[model samples]
Target: MTRREEIVDVAERLLERGGPEAVTMRRLADELGIQAPSLYKHVAGKPEIEAALQQRALQRLAAALEAAPDLPSLAAAYRRWALRHPRLYEIATRLPLARERLAPGVEAAAAAPLLRVTGGDLTAARALWGLAHGLVDLELAGRFPPGADLDAVWTHAMAARVAAGPGPGVTG
Candidate 1:
């Protein structure tokens, strides 16, 4: 792998182990057995590294959503993937994205699957995305009550979205 790729690979490992807070330049350099300055040779710094990871995370989520047959399946896939990589999901969705840092079309491609499933209804697509993100964030934060049947909540939410149907001006 290229040096930049190696840096990101290690950064992701750190993120998985301890969230964004743990992905320091010093730690990454340590993991890579190089001076921290060497990281700057590969990447600008933490924000650049994070932007790369965010792109990767979005690409992964888009792939998952693209494979789903319908809204319910999409919701299930989104929740499952997010739960499996909570820290990555948080980094990808929780913060304000530096859109310019992302590769051209990466953000659009990530949203394409949802827009397609929602019949290009941007509002509905956004609302669905919000719902999924909110639920996943809450679950990640351990905000749900003990024994909460989270599956049912997801099911109901998808059902509601489907029932609402596509809105006017169906263009994402």
Candidate 2:
């Protein structure tokens, strides 16, 4: 990999291990066995590193969501991706990126599957996206009651959403 790629890869590991606060230039340089100032040659600073990581995460999420057969499958795929990569999910979902910093079309690509499932109904797609995100966030936060079957709950919720049809004013 290129030096820049190497730097971002290590930074992402640090972020995964200890969140954004842990990924300092000095720490990254030390992890690379290089002097701190050398990192500047590769990355402008922490913000650049974070943006790279976020872009990678978004791409991965878009791949995961792509080609899902139906809404339930899409929800399941999203939850699966988040559960498998909690730290990445945390960054991808919680960290707000400035519009200019976002890789062009990445966010829309990630949302495309949902839009297709909703028959291009943006409102319904957004509502479904919100439901899936809320469920995953709650589960990740350990908010579910003891003995609760999360998979069953997720299945039931998706079923209910499908049964409810599209949101008000959405034809399908």
Candidate 3:
């Protein structure tokens, strides 16, 4: 792999292991067995590395979401992905994204599937995304009580939204 790709790979590992704070240039360099200054030769710095990782995460999520046959499947895919990659999801969804650093369309691509599944209703799309993210975040944070039957919770919540029906002129 190319040096930049290698750097990003290692950065992802660090992020998965310890969240954003664990992904420092010095730490990355240490993980890669190189001097801290040498990381600059391959990547701009931590922010750039983070942007790259976010792009990757979004691209993968978009692919998963796009492949879903229905809203429940879409919601399941969203939850499964977030739970599998909690730190990556956390960083990718964090506010004040480094949009300028990301490749063009990465953000929109990630959202497009949700928009489509919501029948182009932006509010509904946001609500679905919010529900999925909030539930995953709570689960990751251990906020749910033991044996909460989260699968049922997800199904009930999504069923409620689906039953509400899309807004005017909307079709899913």
Best by TM-score: 1
Task: Flag regions of model 1 displaced more than 4 Å.
Answer: none
lDDT of each: 0.88, 0.86, 0.87
Predicted structure 2: lDDT: 0.86
Worst lDDT 10-window in candidate 2: 163-172
Q: Rank all candidate structures by their lDDT, best first, as comma-separated numbers.
A: 1, 3, 2
lDDT of 1 at 126: 94
The TM-score values for the models, in the order shown, are: 0.94, 0.89, 0.90
Off by over 4 Å in 3: 169-172
Candidate of highest lDDT: 1
Candidate 3 whole-model C-alpha lDDT, 0 to 1: 0.87
TM-score of 1: 0.94
Model 3 sits at a Cα RMSD from the real structure of: 1.9
